[model samples]
Target: MSEHVLPQTELEAWGTDVQVVVCETCDWRFVLPAETSLPRCPHCFGTELELLSGEVSELPYVAPPEQAVPFAVSEAQLTGGIETFAKGIPLPPKDLNPAALRARLQAIYLPRWWVDAEVAALWQAEVGFDYEVVSHQERYSDTVGGWQARKVHEGRVRWEPRAGRLRRTYENVMAPALEAEKALRAQFGDYDVTRARPYHVDMVRRAPVRLPDRVPAVAWADAEMALRRRAGDECRQAAKGDHIREYRWQPAYPKRNWTLLLLPAYTTYYLDDEQRPQPVLIHGQTGRVIGMRKASLKRAQRIALILGLMALIIFVLSSISLLAVAVAPPLLVLGGIGLLVGMVLGLSALAPLIVVWRFNRPRRRPQER
Candidate 1:
């Protein structure tokens, strides 16, 4: 990641006095002005919100973002995603369709921390240099009684011990700003940070921005690893070596800076059969949807019931035809056909019922790391 420094005035704009509110139902955090009117929880739309007593600056594990990727997905694009998701469901709920889902869409910004640092380190490694050796091969053919000579080139690596003491600056090493960073990434994939613009309050208007849950202390380990990888690349380039192996380094970061980066996403939920909210997430830049596909129990049951009635009617007609076989000998063939048809219809009726059962069964999704 490359560094883009914000001007002093822009940095100071994020330092305004703000109040933090926590939702009692969903535990979602919201940051607003101290005197601003309270709003319902954006995640669950619950009215129960509590104001944190202390100042926003004293809030633990929360920091303002320095950059953000503004939402690029329009409402029309999100409707397309929802429509695609609504398809292929065996018995979908009425509210789970595209229009209803789109109505509940909420813009959200996820967090990633970018760290900048100045480091001084002494590093040592075995650097490998590539070389080619040419050798001549002689072959004798029995038919010709002649010798043939061929040249072969083989590639080889030469390893040499290299050591260096260096002072360097590394910037924009990204680390997860959220505790559930892995799950969020698995849910929404990666955001294009190259398109990230300087953080402005206008970009987040009417949107819920998630506070950073991973503090700098916890995130520093990841940042350090990124920095070391960059240092290794620099060392290889400096030595003019093809590869570096068994690299070791002792580094001290004399100065370090951490800034938050906000990634755009859209969140919404649909009510399931039991009227429980099931959350859905969509990428703001790319129209990707991630969530559970719920089956409607009522619809499944209704279809099963209709099929059951048809099976019953077929069974009754077959029974009546079988009785008529005794009255007329020619009717025996008709009776046999009716019996066969009834059995097929009866078996087909079980399909809808089985589908309902399978769709309603509890399924366990893979746990995200």
Candidate 2:
């Protein structure tokens, strides 16, 4: 929308602590106020619009992201991934193919926050130590000693005082900005956050950057809990004799480093035949793709029916073989027919699976009738 076209009153400015910009043209909003040098709106398709609400508001309620996993997966790899994912579902629609659907792939940076803190405390715990001891056993010797007893020896633990400090740069522990985080992970698998880098907006040039919605206080609390979990795990690993079950500590002089990080992803929306927006998510860094793809249930059912009919044929042939066995005692011919029919039914299963795989593949090309 042109600046001359937008309404005068600004809608409420919403989003995180960083820069904020409102589109005077369309109602669409964006983080990071528009640069004076840049003529068009970056977020809303570059509509020539005036900034209705250029007011900067403190994003105290949101946690800025710290770092991110750089893009490792390429477009080809993502396409292949999408193709593989489409193959597993049952009875899909016909219009869900890579060629038939419109897919737009743009990289997006998701928001996350990191916290660092220190803990100091007076703690008390008994650490375990293992020792071996022998006990005399008296037992009956096979034939010579009629009444003898046996003693057994065993190893046991001794309590000891243990103390330690834990520290680490916890990387890639994630928070989801996307509404479909679960479904995305289900499709692309898990991310290893150890490789994350500090957040930089320019790195994510093409797609939108999501800002955290969590307030600093709440995010800090969450980070503390996460840090404690990590510390507990370290304690258990360091235990020599047995696992560490419980812990008590007082944290002191806690200093925190807060960061805003971005995760990469590609998002595209397609208008199905019904004109509904069907969105797809791709792992921007790894190009691992996952989305809803369509397949023809009718086609699959037809193939399945053929296979089922072959199964029926196999059963019939087997029955005939049994009958022939009763009459002629030589039923090898009927048995061979049964085997052939069984093979045909087995071959019938491939069609549906193939149909599904094709359905999930990202449409590099548009679908045709």
Candidate 3:
């Protein structure tokens, strides 16, 4: 009966599944499905989160979700995140300010693939267990009879080849169910899905439900790999008292099904210098934002020049202190001044290096007219 209920439309733009969610302030529209209960947004999270027992709900799809990792980043975390993204730039577009970016940040419901699999796996690996002993020898000497002199310490690890049958049902190991998996991963890193919750749409509002560019079938290998990798790593952990050198897991995954899971992201865009669009992706799980930023080479140069001048001033001051030390013994003062000079030059060197690092980090993609 559940198999008959699973929605398997030929992978296309989720037109009917997505609704255009609009912003009241700017009237910007993001196509999102109408959800009843969902994870709280990192930027706009408030009450209705918890009391005594943690709430568990189901996503309105075929599969059941076992976990939902709520967004862990606080507002301060977001500020630091945006700052890191803006650190280095060559003449950043005038509009690239945190205030502007924060004002435009939109909460998005990125799709996650929920996988239900009855995995029967046979795995082989080298297991290692460790032991250590402090060994001391009783050596009697003529002068000091029966005296404890030196203690020897050595470590030992017991390793052996092991094979086992691992049969387990992974309730909902999230596979990348979205078609836009690459773009999303490029924008935001992997989420901690152990904290995933059953999909409820009510707590969150603005959902930039960009339909998955990848179909479920296209992502099956990825799905299997995710589960297999997890199973192997965890099973190896169960081997207990041994370090796993190498492992191979051949799992027979039968009755694999899907669920529509949602994740959190703060998406915003800032126009670059060339009037091109630059998208910002914030991790709904961690509040880590990844996006391209333009740095001001001129600003870097100006800052460097000022620092160089400061270095020169410190050098002169150190020399002056040394010369004047005849009256006051400026060894400490002059050394302090020299240290200050070195710090200035070091800072000057770092400014341009930071600028170069940022400029090369993300390549600017020109928008086609």
How many residue pairs clash in model 2?
34
TM-score of each: 0.77, 0.53, 0.55
* Cα error of candidate 1 at position 77, Å: 2.7
lDDT of 2: 0.54
lDDT at 217, model 2: 49
- Ranking of all candidate structures by their TM-score, best first: 1, 3, 2
Displacement of the residue 204 alpha carbon in candidate 2, Å: 4.3
Give the CA lDDT, 0 to 100, for residue 246 in model 1.
90
For each candidate, how many residue pairs have backbone atoms clashing (under 3 Å)?
A: 0, 34, 28
lDDT of 3 by residue, 1-369 (tens): 133354433212342343333333322223344443432222222222121121111122322222335666788988888776765556576677788778777666666667787888889988888888898877778777566657888988888888899888887666675545666576456877767675444323345443343446666678788787777677668888457768887789767766666677776666665555566778877887776666545556666777777777777777777777777885767667696766768577566748655665655552111
| Candidate 1 error regions (>4 Å) | 1-19, 24-26, 32-58, 129-158, 295-298, 328-334, 350-369
Task: Give lDDT per model, in order.
Answer: 0.75, 0.54, 0.60
Q: Which ranges of candidate 3 are over 4 A from the true structure?
A: 1-30, 33-91, 133-156, 178-189, 192-197, 200-205, 234-239, 297-369
What residue pairs clash in candidate 1, if any at all? none
- Candidate 1 residue lDDT tens string, 136-161: 99999988789999999999999999
